[model samples]
Target: MNRSFPPLFLFLLLIGCARNSEPTTVATETADDDWWKESIVYQIYPRSFQDTDGDGIGDLNGIIERLDYIESLGVTAVWLNPIYSSPNDDNGYDISDYRNIMTDFGTMADFDRMLAGMHERDIKLIMDVVVNHSSDEHEWFVQSKSSRDNPYRDYYHWWPAEKGDPPYRYSLFDAEGNAWKYDSTTDAYYLHYFSQKQPDLNWSNPKLRQEVYDIMTFWAEKGVDGFRLDAFQFAAKDTTYPEFPGLTDTTFIDYYAMQDGLHDYLREMNEQIFSKYGVMSVAEGAGRNFEDAHALVDADRQELNMAYAFDGVDVPKYGGYALTTMKEVFSRWDAEFAEDGWLSIFLSNHDQARMVSRWGNDSPEFRAPSTKLLNTFLLSMRGTPYAYYGDEIGMTNIDFDEIEDYQDIAARNGYTKARAQGKDMEQFMRELNFLSRDNGRTPMQWTEGPQAGFTTGTPWLPVNDNHAQINVAAQEDDPNSILNHFRQMTRLRQDHPVLVHGSYELLLPDHEELYAYTREWEGVRMLVVMNFSDEGVTVDLPELENAEVVIDNYESLSRTGSSADLNPWQAVILSL
Candidate 1:
């Protein structure tokens, strides 16, 4: 008998267990109110998830084919990265049409089939909402650029080309020092904080805002559970277009997002669309202060349900985040949102490097254990946890040798700008190996076959060379595989109320190798201990009578009274 195929009796037994273990009651009374607060969100980058029809690109059918795999991981919500019709300038972030599906992904019928498949599995689907900008190829932008008085000209930020570059504003992208791109057709420059191909939408336009609301309503009515607003802070900008005071460096990072009118716009959005449909919405809160992060999700403000804070992903540490910084960031957010606000807790996403590579050891020996440690921390946290695609199986960053091996616009643009700045191209390439968004965009490894079983033809991006050893098929058979560990950890989160709604308290915050924290709720307390390093550590755990080891990466727990010796990259959860 094949090890991958369990005995008939064992298979029947496992099925019985699964049916019996289905969640029939909330972990806590409060959890019954909002399903999202207690649910785990799995993010899928459609272009890399799977491929069908030998198209070399992941499509809706591929996702549908793998729906059982996703459902088996116990993720209640799937947050798909942008799948709207696009020119692929920013990997679907630049939407060309609001209602149509990308031809590369599939058609509306395929999308409907995928949606129905997810609903059948009792899973919710969250669509990406990229309203901050649209592809320059979008019909709206094409009309806006036709003439100064084309009526649609107000749909995007436009200034007279005669005014000589419109007073020099900053752009987070476009290292060329000009956020405005000259269009000869209209003879004016449109503002684009990112690549010139992605024109920032003019949120001040009432008609444009109405159109966005209509787009959102269309999806909401179509049964999408929620929307993850992309680059949402940039949706509202300072219309005044004031120049910086005596600024020498014109990098446009700080001035674009979190403008004064953003909150009003969010409230208006909620009032018009989100509130009406009664759907959850999260935003990408880049460039926001702590206050703004809280304000965006404060229940009274009537904006988004949650927003992602970049302190973890944006941390300057070349390796993993410092323990102090992790404790500080999470604790601060916990304190800020303890009363009213909500936050989406995640360490990696489509635009970030794999967390196991960035924060944990990704070597052959430590990858699985370290990945478990990271997942334990994420799922056991106070806020809703988001697991990025491929991270659950301990996917590591891919190191491409040449710039042409990369497909991301940001990576290519950064390389070009860095070379122009006389930076060492080799060193820049090294940084890209670690930080490039392309690191997370590689094809998902499904098996040891050609193309890692992702496609029958060439893949959009090269599959990692280690795919043969690290693919899902091999791990699915191992009970102790990282994939199984993720499944177990995900189930633990869904079953334990303390992991979701408990008050968080940092333990041993200054410990160099140990990340220790406690979550308490309704007379229940659980301690989560993780060793972030590859070296063993001894920590004095709190004395709790009748404490039991509820979950652990390794099967064994070495405890000497109140002091416990942890193995390399070991993680444990103690019920007290």
Candidate 2:
């Protein structure tokens, strides 16, 4: 029961529930005749989910074995992270072979069987697509750098040494923060928005683009139902390599994301691959604004199925974020897409930290209730919700004290960069403890025994120490457990269309401690009231006759007509 959370970061203020007469955000029927609209996408980080072999890494056969567990959660679809062949540079993000599976994760036959097992259980499979870059060890990259005149040279961006140093660009995972890495053999600098081992693919090349489309078709033909494009917003770059004055001072995504010609590529991608197979599509990062998001997913755009914006996920950093900003960001996005297009609602994912630690109270006293409240929000939101594997059981951050415990390339390289710059090592470790992706990458906790029953061998990443108190087996039979609350919420969502196609209206948008909203569609209207604080609070609820409770995190509801009393961390759904 070691329940230590990170420094108060997100949901610092995320409080009480109340509703208004007039809607502050737009509301419309957004179901556009698509299967993905109603899907509860459960994201499984393959390396951390389960391991059948004694290799300490989760694999496709492991997923096949656990198909029943996924089905039990009532999730309609599973968004499996990359299992593609890789050198493990970025833990499978840097792909060496787009067509084969990583040796640690198993073979193509295992993947096919896993996909079939999911389909048998009525669960669709969404494969993670990492075409933004390829491993430097990939055949294409190896051949491209063999000689300057090689036919594969155009597959990647290159600036000959004869031309002066390549224009400055930023790398998200590089230790030196340099995007250009020089090759001695070709005497040229190649572009990489991530680690030096991962070279950015040239989407500008028609040949390269077609090759990507063909690889996608290969998976589609194998019966994969969806694709989550990884770091794809930066796929189409401004090859002109223009210089910026305040590059380091400004956020890098502004210059690197949603570049020119991106729409054309997406449209072409859908027409050639997505449209033909009728598979759902979503990119990892949305653009800087709403217009960019809409262009990527609007029904008329013929591009993608959902806009997986990062505004909600990126708002939490450093010390804390304003509760008002969290509400505004979600409300504004809902307003923008109320009429058309779609959004993926989520608070954490493979690349982010844990949900409750970052966005809710993770202390021992309030962990279960607060985690349930957070899942209630995610499940009842106005879009298709993506649930990371461990979030359902209230997994908090591991908060490793030293850098050696960190395995993610970002954390390791970031530490190197911080030390090189003479920054305070203690301060850097504190922030890393709170924000490192490893916080979300811990192995799934299934039991109270050694290694949380994740593997007989040591886990690829250490299992969270608090697994004894917070695990699937411990909470499986408790009706009041966070795990059960999550199950009930997902079942309610799947049983009710109002949660999917309803018009969402934010209630008491400015309240400091209350978050209240209502979802109404057709002839049904339901109110969602959540108390996101540690003290009991009161909020005036709407007056509706014959109100019956649909679902609630707490054991009982307290209230009289308009004035409803809420216990700390209580969440409720009522039908009117």
Candidate 3:
């Protein structure tokens, strides 16, 4: 299936024929009913969202109190990060008890109430299901590592010490990048693709796979609408431990991601749980390429509902990334899945740093416009858009000077590794400052008060200093504010079905400072042009000849017949 994609100018330049007033989805193949497809998913990093208790951590009750604020964003769903009982080694990702909520978060009753609250507001709740690994403290892991003859011993991958060494598997969060951690008690070395405290589960084992399914069904029956399978792409592994050649220089994800038997497990899980209760499933990654992505999703496979690919989000770097590069990646992905599979559109989440600081200009003067422009790009894209919580109000990164200031396990472990390997500590710190996951986990800014009104007590992480000027309460009344612009963008996307199910045609595909595109459905056509940089640029898209401004980030626009002069970080949606 070798295919090539020239730039798409269909709606903007070559609407050829099929121009009719009857509304329709661009692709011939689609689902009979698609709620998740039309959804605007707002990702909430619960630990930093709000804190009701004096424990300095966000809990279910805190989220319940803020339901109204979330509903006001016009979002259709909320994707909450893991709240399962954890050892806090890698935050809530290291699950100890899948059925119970973290004590810092609250009890099961609080979770029930939170789900009910979201449902009552007509907003769906997507729970994070971290099945790739479990905390060493998990009952199964504890029992499995207790003895070689334990009933749960097969639940995790273990190598007897007699075998000398388990093949070297890379660890993303280990202090010493070794995936095999020796256990004295069982005389075995267990595999952990992350922290030693977090052991990767044996997906090849049937009983262990059933355990994950049961846990998901437990939540689905409790009314969870969707599941974001965290790190699940790397769930399947070859128990024989085959050696990957030339792996030192290549990214481990190539060998680690989308292993052989992953699709079978997903298909079985879908038939056993998802098909039963109508749950939506989106795995963390789309694998390495189009074929891998399609195999995981493609609808006919009955595997996953959406491919939450990291290509777009992975575009930003400490040394800046190009607008053309982002456009190319996103446009290529959109074209790849234009017919069969679904994509999840997002730039920032719990795992990445602040969106404004990474993808947009977060400087005092340009923050609002840049953030709004980014939002415009997200909403106008042809995919299920995911908006990170603080992104709506333009949150910036809290670049820490020292590793001591970071709480992220990735950063702390990385710093330790840098020092141990005698690498360039200064450059490593620079990368850490710009790309630390802690930047996104900072406490949300609700008001200009003590702890930025996130909590009455001290926060789990220090609130960004910019919270005083950039907050929900400060921008609520200002229609031109970043927050309002986000709301406006959401509302516009909701009103125009074209924005959701339309064909996206890339205009000026080679532009370095701008991303201009058009979305057309039925006979309705819209041109969305955004200047992604801090430079005034006039775009000449003649498709906008008789265009009428529908909405814009700026209060006013300087436009002629077919061209418009965009101020730095300006964005506009024009109806042609």
Candidate 4:
């Protein structure tokens, strides 16, 4: 022992000490050094994307098999929906364990393989991180619920019944009463915002915060490039639990989960965990306003790199009214957070209906025109664009004949609520057909085969009947297919600086059926002209007199004139 340690050991010790003595470079840990901020992200709902085990559910291996296809689309990254161990209460939004891959999806080895394959293709992988709440079945939740005095009890939000106040009074519940459920074994009520099985996490506790931070670090160490924070705005709540002013007088309680200090916690998480891993953190603030959103992603705040803004894309369908007009919606987004922060522009996601059916036409005759128009508007906007799986092929929503055809909790709940409200069955069914998550969750249309080539057996959800006509195999051969158009759009965005990180100015602001905008960046100006109607229209383009046609939906476009005539549902990209 007195002979001294080996030279190799001493050398390693000296290197470690030198590393500790060196100054830590924060910029090296920030993903802003990468090009992810300007990249297009394609979202894949794993269970519905592909299946390799013939179990009717997608697995990591299935995604690995489709790496080439994903890369061929010209997308820079893929934001996978939750693939962690879960009971599927909210379709993987409720995590039982953060470190393990769901048995249904595949093993941890399969995940690593997929990550490696994506890396080889130069594609970034953004995992979905659901930290707002954990599944009731989670070990921490189970231990927390074991005893009121348990050391883990504070891991989740637990409350006692107020005097003379019903223990059942809670938010998010219908006639069933409180969202909190009493555990017989624990003899305490646990809070849940979405479902009884998903208990809200107590972020007020420092230990719980550290546990979450550790979990994020675990994944970061395992080579996760980034994360899409699920329902991130709901992470912090008002500790006082004060009742809304209207709650005493009316049944409507305007309870907002994103209270004060949420941004502080988010910024801390970014600085401590994500920043260290060089990961891109995107927050999902579904119902936040421009003020809150701007603060969350403002470069100076360093809370989030970007957030998913639902305001512009959630077109209401009440009274035969298409919520906000396209102009009003896009202009609001263009004016609000354009200068301060980045926006995640998306038309469809796992929670929403298929964009081709909801925003575009679903019929055979009008589908192509509407799909192209929608894509033109989305890609031309000044932000990062996210395309849902199967969107490139112009996929339509699945038409289920019965309630049993659906597996989504939200869809089933909506159907029951619709009928309980005495709504007309036909209208209710139509709404369900249009708005259900099943519409977007249907197995990806891969080919004309059993289960649409997504799985060997029956899919977890039924494949759309039109898969035979619109499958990826068929469209891949057609250069003018919707899938090819999407590739072209992405390529153009990559080639043109004005399309990404540019200033947007709306043209023809009052035009109902015409959506036109100019994107100017570093002296390069490009105009996007789109006709949202089915009839041809002539628009004055005096500002584009010297502009030449760069891209158009139709082959023939008039380039020599100041004012150009547009065909029915036509779009053109012009540049000077």
The 10-residue segment of model 4 with minimum total lDDT is 9-18
Per-residue CA lDDT of model 4 for 1-576, tens digit only, reads 011100110000000000111111111121454466578899999999989999899988999999999999999999999998999887898899999999999999998899989999989899898887899999999899888888999999887544223233343322232556767675567777657888989888889988999999988998888888886676787766655432210122124445777877887899887778889888775334566666877788877878677655554342232312546676666666555677788887887778877776668876776787778777887777888998888898777778778787755655665577677988666666666777888889999987889998878878889988889998898887888888889899889867876677777767766778787776778889987666778888786698887878777665446887887668889886
> Candidate 3, after superposition: displacement of residue 156 in Å?
0.3
Q: Against the true structure, what is each candidate's TM-score?
A: 0.93, 0.95, 0.95, 0.90
C-alpha displacement of 556 in model 4, angstroms?
Answer: 2.0
Count of steric clashes across candidates, in order: 3, 5, 0, 0
- Compared with the true structure, all predictions reach lDDT values of 0.80, 0.85, 0.85, 0.74
Which runs of model 4 end up more than 4 angstroms from their true locations?
1-34, 161-177, 245-254, 316-324, 419-422, 558-560
RMSD of each: 8.9, 3.8, 6.0, 12.8
What's the lDDT for residue 397 in model 1? 87
For model 1, the run of ten residues with the poorest summed lDDT: 9-18
What is the TM-score (0 to 1) of candidate 3? Answer: 0.95
